[model samples]
Target: MGDAPTQQVPGLGDVVGYLDSPTAVCGQRLSVHLSSTVGPTRVRLRALRIGDYQGRGSRLVWQSGAVTARQQHEVEPAGPDRVITERWPVATTIAVDVSWPPGMYLIEIAPLAGGQPSFIPLVVRTSGAHSPYLVVASDLTWLAYNRYGGRSLYFGPGSNHTQSVANRSYVASTDRPVDASGQRTVFKMTLPLVRFLARHGISYDITTDSSLDATPAQLVGQTTVLIDGHSEYWTKRMYDAAVQARDGGTNFAFLGANEIYWQGRIERDARERPTALTVYRQAGLDRLARADPATTTVQWRHAPLLRDPAALVGVGMSVVGVHGAYVVNTAPAWLLAGTNLHKGSVLDLAFGNEVDAQEPPGPHSPANLQVILHGTAMAAGRTKPSLVTAAYYNAPSGAGVFAAGTTYWLCELDSTCPGGPTPRATSGALEQITLNLLRAFAVPRAGRLHPSAATPYESPAWLAKRLPVGGAATGEGQ
Candidate 1:
């Protein structure tokens, strides 16, 4: 399996922390509460701007004098599947100012006492006028899987300290800190994608996950909306805003996979800000909360808001597994452009974690949805093959919707993928294709745009390429 891993060198520092707010607008003041083990130690705060240079990692945006480190938060037993985070007095709330451009910023916190640096993820959002694209961070998913105090929605507190912990926060708050090292995308998807956009000078804005509660309009005037990494947990408003954006002529590029597949509700604080996320992982949860639209929690395709993700993204979540090498299928030139990748091309080991397949072409699923990458997945005991499709479709409003169909899309762009088996050829192909999408989607075209007829469009060849030497199809859509 491919993994995005972190690297460390002597003298160079690394940071491990989370931001109070998942995101902040440019010029807006947001607090960054940093924590460290050593007391009375100076720390340097630097904002590293991600770029495209092969060896050039990032440029420094801002710096700060080292502040004394202290442990202010404590973890304690709360409930079965929760962790209560209590913030104490000792904290240096650094205010992010207007000078910071609207982009992803790596909040590097390095101890002057000589130790590996810690990293806190923060993104400065664009204010007022909309850019070409509105980038969203997968924060809700981050918190959902955060086993900070030893509990997560997946697993409750266990019997021992190593086994489990507990929490009472019925609705977990963003005010609580995330276990930075425990975060998967901060280094894997977020950093690499952000740097890619910056290096290519893509005109874009950014916003956090939960901010969809009060900032659905964040999509206004933007040509494209980009969602990166695992955006599995989504509130109703976030999903609606995306739909509204598509309907309103805003293009979308879901760089991540398994997006908006489940339903979640936002918990508000006294100020009406989203303080927590509530999810029960059952369709019944949404029925119980259907009376109040804000609290509805269920599979998006199940009840109440029975809007299918495949209809919006052109493909819905299906099997969970890996693709040895994503086979290129029928794709428009606007989609393939600079990438030499064409029909019959194989992106070596480019797919993993999870993937989606286009639903049977029908009213709900757009007929225009074209298979960009074709592959298959095996679910352990399943004898039949499940289709893996990276799809693309154009909305009537000239808004293009593309789903990467695999969770590993952005990670493939990460040149630092762990182990010696990095997909060098696959990475380059994905890079140019991403740039092509951004450039093409940013432009307003009359009617919907599709891949040129000059390009070959064949799914059979793709399937044939993926099929084993003498294997035959058990059945279609199996």
Candidate 2:
């Protein structure tokens, strides 16, 4: 919110719009769509690079002169998925050349004739970048929560939209503007981590989930891949690419919880450009499941594809609406160096909203999975309390992976997390832990140099009982 107004207009009835796409490479042209109740409104737009720049929070990159913006009508919802597409004419077009550096950007549109000012977030990616660190924004998740045009994949306008199955869209188009709620998600979830990275002078490349799907090669050869903030939805191509990267010795940091829960795919227009995000909530009943089962948008651990999420992140989602704090259980000297955390020390309100834990009697976790921090929360719609676990593991490929198992990890850095403010001592401890994790993962073949220690459950005595007498007992057989 640097060059843009901090307060957003009340509703979508004011001036609102979105870009033709969420991402762009240098030398590509971007179209900005606009609709306004104030006809012939004088519009002033600017592109601001988003991050913490000495506490200013943003830097102005480009600005556009006054342009005439007119009211554009919205197209009605179509198809069983209730796909909402805005066929608004382009109010302005911006040429993204080498002058604009590659990073996260936002286009601020202000109507001078008295209307609301809106913003369209964009990520400028570079194809040739092979930075030591890469941050992938959860753009797909942002769209999933976007309530623009009166419908989202989850919620709608009235009381009828409150139900999980009724009045929801299976497919949502990117042509519509992101509402105020989606904008708040960016500030609350993603921006704090971005600021922390920038303040630490960590040189990294940033891209969106859709861009990674379009060009998977961008993910290869990176020392570390960091996925931040509530990244619940994933495309098959994106999931496959991440697995391939990990297998090839690229480290990963899942800094947020509830990741890769559901499968989704991108739909394209006749021109072969990505148009809508499609996901069938109840994949078993989907008509497409009869023909192509993989295309169904079921949970990752469900039928047809029984790939459990714990196998990837070392923990599976357990409870939602959790407001507990992380209590240190087994902090390795290497991971928790310089921090005052010890066994049984609690970090105030470090876990909340949603969390993950090791699921027993279900799918198995990765080899040498270590639970460093633990928390407990009352399971949603249930009376029993569930445990939340933050874990780490070293893959056979010599790639290190750590899962935070909570959505509010980064939010603690900038003190923007909901529920309450994190104490200074708690914030410092988490920040140091993050710095240590990032610096370690930035090294090539991190697992080879700093292999994970055996957890209590993976001790020789624990493994001996599960194996044959003469057979060797390795930590890998959990």
Candidate 3:
């Protein structure tokens, strides 16, 4: 085969790299590793405060001097898992100080001659942040889907078009380039919210899923912890930490669906640095049922660990490959107080991709669950349709939890979605609802002040009969 074409933008030559660590504390240091075909490269680092600043999408926080670019050795995937370890030489080292606020940042590297730049996502964390809200970036999920060296946790290395777990990796390394620098999830889910928060003057701190797994104590004393985007993977420590925080009256808002579904853990190196995410998928066979069943990499709701996510998030992912809109069930409600939306108002294209629904009033569900939005989506190859629900509940500890029941919620904040542009009116209503929830949850023990009203549709028997669509919304047992 001919020489591989350089990964470049516009006029720039190829240059790809990853940080020695995905995250760094404000006072710590981080190294940048790069392999470039470009003669000389310049590093332009920016902390993304407001994602879309006049359509630029970033604010220049920091920049580094031009560095010598060296063409490093081409390392391919090794071992049965096809883990690509990029042990490139450090081109530059950065000292993260007080100027670097704790938030999501992007490091852009390109040729000094000017070209399309490559990006690396970094989360600057703080140990003693007492912000009323905490936003946990779904870094683990981004790393899981990272297909840098032609392989990822979901697809094997090759030109094979089919994406199957059978040919996928059981482990994904953090020391390699993540496809597109994980901009897809970061921009779609986290950045929009960050922009919204900054615009609304909401003070919130940001951290990574790994940080939550490593030092979950940071979650303590916070009023609310926001888990946004497709947070699919979770470790026992992360799960327990969230539950503990919630029980301690720290409210939570899962702004996206398909969260806390898989069980996984971060494997650290000898130096105690996170090197890879190891998840040996049980895939329904419960292959590790006998050995360390508690830590098996199966669905959290599966056997050996009958911990249903719905018990925590108010709703669990029930359907995949879903495409539809959210049909309002109850408006003039607390969340929809300032919005123009009312019962039966359809938020077009608000539900797509994956979605969650409360199964029934069982042991896995919250006791006083209130369904805010209910709709239906037809899943692939299913004779019957599945219900999508956005709900809220007040825990016995007086902590409130809101589940958006759809992964597309965050993107809708900017009127952007997979299928098409979300209607401006619909986006405005959703934004108002989000603002209401955040404002209410910013206070400690918010449920005690503004508790969820009881709903009759919490029962499976009741939900089985109601359609909850347009025209009949008021009679859906609200």
RMSD of each: 5.7, 7.3, 6.1
Instruction: List, residue by residue over 1-478, the lDDT tens digit for candidate 2.
Output: 3653322222343577788888888998999888886666788888888776777777888889997778888787788778899899998898898888888887888776655567888888866656788889888887877778778877655655256447778887888898865665565566667778887888788888888887888778888998886788888888889988888999999988899998887887675567878777787556787788876788888877677878878888876666766778787888899997898787877776667875553446765788888766553465546667788888889999999988878877766676557788888998999999987887867888777764543322332243221211111100
lDDT of 3 by residue, 12-124 (tens): 22777788888888778888888776545554443444444545545666777777667787677787656778788888888888877777777767557766666777888
Off by over 4 Å in 1: 1-18, 38-42, 79-81, 159-170, 180-182, 283-290, 417-420, 445-447, 451-478
User: How many Å off is the CA of 328 in candidate 3?
Assistant: 1.5
Would you give me the overall lDDT of model 2? 0.76
| Higher-TM-score candidate of 1 and 2 | 2
lDDT of each: 0.64, 0.76, 0.74
Error of 2 at 449 (Å): 2.2
- What ranges in model 3 sit over 4 Å off? 1-13, 37-56, 158-164, 283-291, 457-478
Candidate 3's error at 214, in angstroms? 1.0
Assess the local accuracy of residue 103 in candidate 1 as a C-alpha lDDT between 0 and 100. 70
Which is the better candidate, 1 or 3, if ranked by TM-score? 3
Structural similarity to truth (TM-score) of each candidate: 0.84, 0.91, 0.89
**Candidate 2, residue 129: lDDT:** 59
